[model samples]
Target: MKPQHLLAAATLVLATTAFAAGDPHDHAHAHTPLHGGVVVEVKDIDYELVAQPSVIQLHLRDHGKPADVSNATARLTLLTGTEKQEVVLKPAGDKLEATGSFKVAPGSKAVAVVTVAGKPSTVRFVLK
Candidate 1:
């Protein structure tokens, strides 16, 4: 290929790669688990689920800041093998919490349907 043609092709490839990489600043919005639980993000909000034998907690955060769960409610479905358990969580302090005898073990899965300000979002997690 001619020199000019090769230069144009290289520039195009570089531009495409950069565009596909997305904005570097977007890393600031990445979600991380805060309560030593599994975290999933939906609609720019982070939901962390902490599953324990005696209690379950769901923590919410937006842009790394604690989100208000004062009026929010969540319904969690816990799956362990063929046994499924359901629990309703209500706002308690800065997180949604429910207390009961739960079956939480390694490799258990849970799905949380959370509602905040009339908007509902679903978050799924696999316990470790």
Candidate 2:
């Protein structure tokens, strides 16, 4: 195409990215959860943050094995940028919920040490 058309297209793309980057309304799909185990990934997790029951702040997966996380004995390592904290995890219904303690600050990274049956396991979650 012409140079002017190319410039206009480039300008349009930059404008769109800038708009998406700076606007809070563009927070679509940001609330989606990321479920993974055996490897740490940056995704939303379905773990509760402390005992709020309203906010879950943990990352874990069943791994589809009876030998993995079958008994539920885990610890959630919370990291708020520079600050670090730990939350105990217990079997709450079908999910592993943090025990009554601290409210997991939003946007904090979480690393978990889960002990299932008699085996120790690990997983990490990057805050949504």
Candidate 3:
């Protein structure tokens, strides 16, 4: 093969190899809700929000393992049509929970801001 053809072939091989390697931070795992709630994944962490009429719960998990939320706090904003409600959740047992009247319904949306050890992460959910 000619010198130019040889260099082009080498470049093509390296590019193909790099593409096949894929991303190191890519998490292609399934996120199934443990509490029968809406689950969202952020930065490899899963946040499940179980919104009920009388209580709200936010569960955190990292790679299928329960994440530590003992020093964490969460604030949720729930929107159901024209009605909006906000609630603050404290760490309770293995999850963050709050007890109060909430307007959670089908097709409702929620935005949770969870802070753990001074770092905060936000997760959005749509109730079904």
Candidate 4:
């Protein structure tokens, strides 16, 4: 391979590694599995924690899921400036929803806490 190609490839890999939030076990924002019917295609996903409603809504492009997340529970931790806010989630039918005690403002770092089949699970996502 040409030197330039190798350099570009290395930089691409480094960029992806550098942006990772934290160590896998250190944070709740971990890998999330695609459950339900046909996994929906979510693009430019946005997340928010509304303290008053005790709910976190995952806003993304409408896609089809094979099943519903009605029985799922969502947990969330908002990380920003060394601050972490923890929240619990409940199923909101199609969307895996959760309510949090902390009022996370817009553009906060967030991790999706999805409780699947009564077992505590998580989905990692950055609030954008």
lDDT for each residue of candidate 1 in 7-126, tens digit (9 for 90 to 100): 999999999999999955455765778799988888778899999999999999987889999999999999999999999999999999999999999899999999999999989999
- Could you give candidate 3's per-residue lDDT for residues 1-128 as a string of tens digits? 99999999999999999999985675655689889999998888999999999989999998888999999999999999999998999999999999989998999999999998899998999999
lDDT string for model 2 (22-113, tens) is: 94443333332344222332222223223232444343433321122336787777777787777777665555665454534456677777
**Each candidate's TM vs. the true structure?**
0.81, 0.47, 0.79, 0.43
Better of 3 and 4 by lDDT: 3
TM-score of 3: 0.79
Displacement of residue 102 (Cα, Å) in model 4 is 3.8
Q: What is the C-alpha lDDT profile of model 4 across 9-107, one tens digit per residue?
A: 999999898777453332223223333111112232223333333555542221222334566566667676677877666657556555545545545
Candidate order by lDDT, decreasing, is: 3, 1, 2, 4
User: Ranking under TM-score, best-scoring first?
Assistant: 1, 3, 2, 4
* Candidate number with greatest TM-score: 1
Off by over 4 Å in 2: 1-70, 99-106
Clashing residue pairs in all predictions, respectively, total 0, 7, 0, 10
RMSD in Å for all candidates? 4.6, 9.3, 5.6, 10.4
Better of 2 and 4 by lDDT: 2
User: CA lDDT of each candidate?
Assistant: 0.91, 0.53, 0.92, 0.49
